[model samples]
Target chain A: MTVAVADVPAVPPDLLTVAHLSMRFGGLLAVDDLSFVARAGQITALIGPNGAGKTTVFNCITGFYRPTAGHIALERGDRSFDLDQLSGHRIARDAGVARTFQNIRLFPRMTVLENLLVAQHAKLMRASAFSLAGLLGLKGFREAEARAMSLAEDWLTRLGLVHVADRECGTLAYGIQRKIEIARAMCTEPCLLCLDEPAAGLNPRETAELSRLITSIRGEFGIGVLLIEHDMGLVMGISDRIVVLDHGACIAEGKPAEIRNNPAVIRAYLGEEDPRAGPGSTDAPGAGDGA
Target chain B: MALARAAPTVSSGVLRAAFGEALVAAGIAFMLALPLAGLRLPINPMDSVIFRPWWVVVAVATVFLGRLGLALWRARVAPSRRNGVPLLDRALAYILPWRRGIFVAFVLLVAILPLMPFADRRVIDLGAVVLIYVMLGWGLNIVVGLAGLLDLGYVAFYAVGAYSYTLLIIHLDLNFWAALPLAGAFAALFGVLLGFPVLRLRGDYLAIVTLGFGEMIRIILINWSSLTGGSEGITSIPTPTLFGLTFTAVPAPGETAFHQFFGIPFAGVHRIIFLYYLILALALLTHVFSMRIRRLPVGRAWEALREDEIAARALGLNPVMVKLSAFGLGAMFAGFAGAFFATRQGFINPSSFTFIESAIILAIVVLGGMGSQMGVILAALLLVLLPEVARDFAEFRMLLFGGAMVAVMVWRPRGLLAHREPTATLGDLSRGREPAP
Candidate 1:
């Protein structure tokens, strides 16, 4: 089911284009002159060591942070949204961008089903006529509620969380909570899904399963997947393209095989004195060279 | 280590620890009661303090014995009980299973209480008062419990409702029924007004701002003498009528008295009973509305915002609108209760709606268990009736109330009924599968 990198069109349509993005927190420039492109139906992995401004890029793309200087554009057919100009919520609501946090952010007291339904709030809220129809249990609202419920059930079953669908999310196992977060984000039906460190605290088997699930989501939904992950095995295995960041700048960007051999990427990761001295050394240029 | 030791030695050690702890408790109690209980101030400051040593002795002994019992229970009975189950938890387990039945029974009892022979005029009036608080508690439950917004100025909306009705009747010549909804609408308006400024605040900050807003409204009522009559609140406020029938001993000319319309002799108790039922119906409306809205999308959004605001915003939910809606709806119910208050008492002043009133209502929501409907009723009854029942111990009534609150907090830190059931279930869907156990 995986498409070879060589099979990709020379100019694939860009779902998200973040150019010259710079985010400064007071004196610290968290992200500096970062630029990247995530094509539709492709898994783009943003990988770097801790504090490499990988999450900062994701934040700017998802409208969580206003970049000091940059353009973050999300193209959906005929329409394009400047994510940097929109508020945090509107970026998700109007622009169709959904995201998951590094730390799990499920509504702990709410049931898993409720958490998923909440992700579909914008649609259900409109159907309920701001709760007037829901209050009266009108046919329109009931049908909408049923549709939302089925969507939640579909995600729960797919994620193997059906057994704990009615349980409070906080009471579930950590691995299950991670899966629920992904399910919740998917329920929003975003054009681009940004997952910040999706496999941070998972076992090898769970990480492998996550890789497969993420690939299937990309293939089945035809949505762009922008992932910030530390698990190198999973990242290199599933990513169609990989973007490497170091100290808030793009160090290298290319196919997974190229990134694996790029001397700058190895030097950024291993802190090697010379590019040729690293384990996976290659006669490649230094940082800030985007392929 | 202690449990493995000899039985006699363990018993002796337990006794010694209990006695030491009780002695310390008695010493602390003596120190506290010295100025308050042992010595009392006479009316005149010139007079010497009147010493009441017996009061001090009684206080110390009560503390001593209570502490001794608690210490012994922990050291001796508690360890063995832990192997099985604690008495309180076991009792709760038994009661929790039949909570729905208990709730229905409680409702039935209250519904038929006024008709009971034992329910005198005083009892009915007290019942009405308790129901008013119950309605207020439930109204605040929406904001404080489900939305997780700490609103200390809920009384502002209540005051708004009361004043709205009273002024509408005075200026516009409106009847009670006509003014009730308007009063609620005015309170909701004020709720939204207050909500706008404090939308960014949460927890303690929100509490402080709301507390200030409540006081601001009360102060306005006190200062704005022209519209609100200042400190001298509007008096001779008209009581509510059943249709065109007034509940008066002698009907005004061209007015039909309630008893005359009913073809029965006039009795003051009839008016009291009517007021009781009126407040009961209003409280039930508040209860049913809160319950229904709990399952709605807006309700879920409130709860979702409460759990995690940032995460909620990220998921495309507007925190501003969600918070405002909660504030508006919560205040609407408070307004309804306020209108009822003004009509029932026939007089309302700034003194009636104070910070303490807000505290009492918040206490009921908390002590009852936040967001739990039945818990609010139980807590309102306990909080309102406990003081009235302890009238004989006028000097110690507040003391008893505070003690009961402390005991409940220590035993049930999450409130009396903290268990929450999800608003929707998977089994409700037509999946043709049994719900997970």
Candidate 2:
């Protein structure tokens, strides 16, 4: 039951490092000593069973739920922020960590474009004195507004949401709404993007599009994408590195190929399926993959 | 009810395209048939129109237009992709120099209304008061409508503004104009102070705290007799003047005050007209300011916070700052109205600034439609005017008011004129094809 911290590899000199991150809710330990490094310009996938604490890790990292014990350090070019010490919104605005909810939390009443502009609120505040200076026509105020609008428009075009840019987010289809939510998150131009189940409700085609979108975002935008997806197809396809968690512990970590065949991962997927002679007692296909 | 059903999800464009012409057509036609209906002019309409009512020309026109609008849609238009009208289709889009239209029309209407023989002096005075309420409602709308924060103690700021003006002008011998801005400043400062604590509280908790805050201010106004005159109210407070020409001028023997100035009848009606314009300008200013703010990024942040706090926070918006600004800007308007209220009446008292006043202003914002300046103004007029118009129905007034409010809410839960949040880029909703899921 006691997993030694030293067993994990040394923390990488990456933009974000979570060392010994553990979150417990009363009797239930949601995330137990889960540690991972998110390098810049890469897609990192955290995949696990329904209750495997992938989202719990996201919540802990995003400051929605403060972990019981953890160290989350976020490094910019020169400055570093103690992510664990920051508040939820501060994690977003200050640490440049933006996240989209699993449930697609959008300002449904607001227009699609307004959703994006609002995401750039902090930057806009810096440019405009909370819009008062913008009103007074201060120098650079107009440029900031144009920048915000252009950024919003860019995301809208990228997501193919140009048509519904003025439409209320509530009125869009579930898939489109999800895309808008992601676009809104990107409009913040965060250093790290944490997407909780972005592909959860998407159809197969939509999921494929989402995969391309995530990959392009990392490759083009030069930002780290941390995704918690239930769809193994997406995780297996786009993720450069996969972190597998089982019952709040890191059961496996490597390239997708290595994690796919890890015996511990197989056992984690099918409990009581023997770690020894695993191919014989099969619940479904992929039982032999552990070989 | 049937008409409401037909236009259940009607957008602002549909209403504008169909409502104005329909209202005009219906108004004329209904007016012609009034004699046959035997409803008289029905000087002031009543809620009894709901049950015992014989209708009027205007009423019939509204019904007829509503029906025609529904029929036109059912016959001519096929189901399309667009959800709402584009901004280009707006009326202001059609006209040149549209900003001046409302202002010019307002000035003309105010100037001409008093000149009409049928326009009662009392009615003009009532209109002036309604304008003040419109100003207050627009101010409150910024807080409750745009920000989606329910403020029940808004009258506290109003009281603060009024007292600041009254006490400062009287005790310190400051000019009415000078105290006015200072009153607004003090009230706005207090708004920020109030915003700091109550910003964390949303919905009913925020309401209760504001209500408490309002009551605290009122209790102070009453108990602080040495300064406030303690319910006796500082009377004989000097009314505002225009270039040394006071509303009241001592008549030479048989000559009236107006005679001394311009050889006209001195009925004190000119003062009411001046007050009307003063408040009209204030209300217009409030409407313009709110409209401008609602289009800005901070304004969008307020709305985002209103809709989803979690999402707003995720967007990197500081909710505390947004909420406080809502309170600050909203209270500043209320403060402006409060200063005007004190100067207009030349009297200050605790009872005049009550929780009920706050409720009525809030009610106007709710009934008119939150986030709609025009809707707020219309609601203010309806709520304020209807009560005054129903002086004959005094015993049943409250019942009728409550019933009408309930009925309106039932018919339009969002408000009479719900406005969509403005976006930076207008989307073509028709092109939003929903892929089969």
Name the top lDDT candidate.
1
Q: Which runs in model 2 stand beyond 4 Å of their true positions? A: A1-13, A273-291, B1-111, B243-245, B250-267, B421-423, B427-437
Judge candidate 1 against the unseen true structure and give its global Cα lDDT, from 0 to 1. Answer: 0.89
Following a full C-alpha superposition, what root-mean-square deviation does model 1 have from the true structure? Answer: 3.4
lDDT by residue for model 2 (B354-384), tens = 8899999998989988877766767887898
Q: Clash pairs of candidate 1?
A: none
Instruction: Provide the overall lDDT of each model, using Cα atoms, as 2-decimal numbers.
Output: 0.89, 0.79
CA-RMSD of model 2:
10.0
**Cα misplacement distance, residue A73 of candidate 2 (Å):** 0.7
Question: Clashes in model 2: which pairs?
Answer: B26-B61, B30-B57, B31-B57, B81-B430
Q: Which regions in candidate 1 have their CA more than 4 angstroms from the true location?
A: A1-3, A9-11, A274-291, B1-9, B43-46, B83-86, B434-437
The TM-score of candidate 1's chain A against the true chain A comes to 0.93
How would you encode candidate 1's per-residue C-alpha lDDT over A1-291 as one tens digit per residue? 124666766756899999999999999999989999999899999988789999889888877788999899999878999999999889988898999999999999999999999999999999999999999999999999999999998888787778888899999999999999999999998989999999988998999789889999988998999999877777777788999999999989987778877878777777776445544322222222222
